[model samples]
Target: MEVENEEPSWFVYLVRTSKSALYCGITNDLQRRFKQHQEGKGAKALRGKGPLQLVWSQSEINKSEALKTEIAIKKLRKVQKEHLVKQAVRFDRK
Candidate 1:
């Protein structure tokens, strides 16, 4: 018998706080995770950042890819992150 490796679907997301700050995270369910963040039950860094707005999300990625993408995005300068979000939003709308 062979065990097959299965990849979990994951998403890389960014939320903007009322203070105009960006938060980065990865989740299998973006909507639920965002709700938890809004409810102050998610990441401690984001707990007080409400009302949080889902600013960017990339889907159809596996867990590993999502984590790598999240780290890469987190390391970007704010301007670069903003540019990335803008670029992603443009593609999302298409």
Candidate 2:
């Protein structure tokens, strides 16, 4: 018998906190993650920052790559994250 390989689907997302801060994270289910954040059940760092805005997100082929990309975005400064959000908004508008 032959084994079939399955592709991984991962999501890299950015959420804007109530303080206008950006939080970067990766998950397999974007909707669930967003719900968790909204419910204050997500990352401990994000607690008390409810009503977050989904600023940006992208899908990746694998969890590892998604995590790496999320880490890279998280390492960016606030200004950089803002710039990214603006760019994404521009693309959406276009």
6-75: candidate 1 lDDT, tens digit per residue: 6557888889999989998999988899999989999999977788899888874478777777787788
**Which residue pairs overlap in candidate 2's backbone?**
none
Report the backbone clash tally of model 1: 0
**Residue range 1-94, candidate 2, lDDT tens digits:** 9976756588888898888878888899999999999999999879998678998988877898887787777777788778878887421211
lDDT of 1 at 85: 76
lDDT of each: 0.81, 0.81
Off by over 4 Å in 1: 1-8, 89-94
Superposing all C-alpha atoms, what RMSD in Å does each candidate have to the true structure?
4.6, 4.8
Model 1 steric clash pairs: none
Report the number of the highest-TM-score candidate. Answer: 2
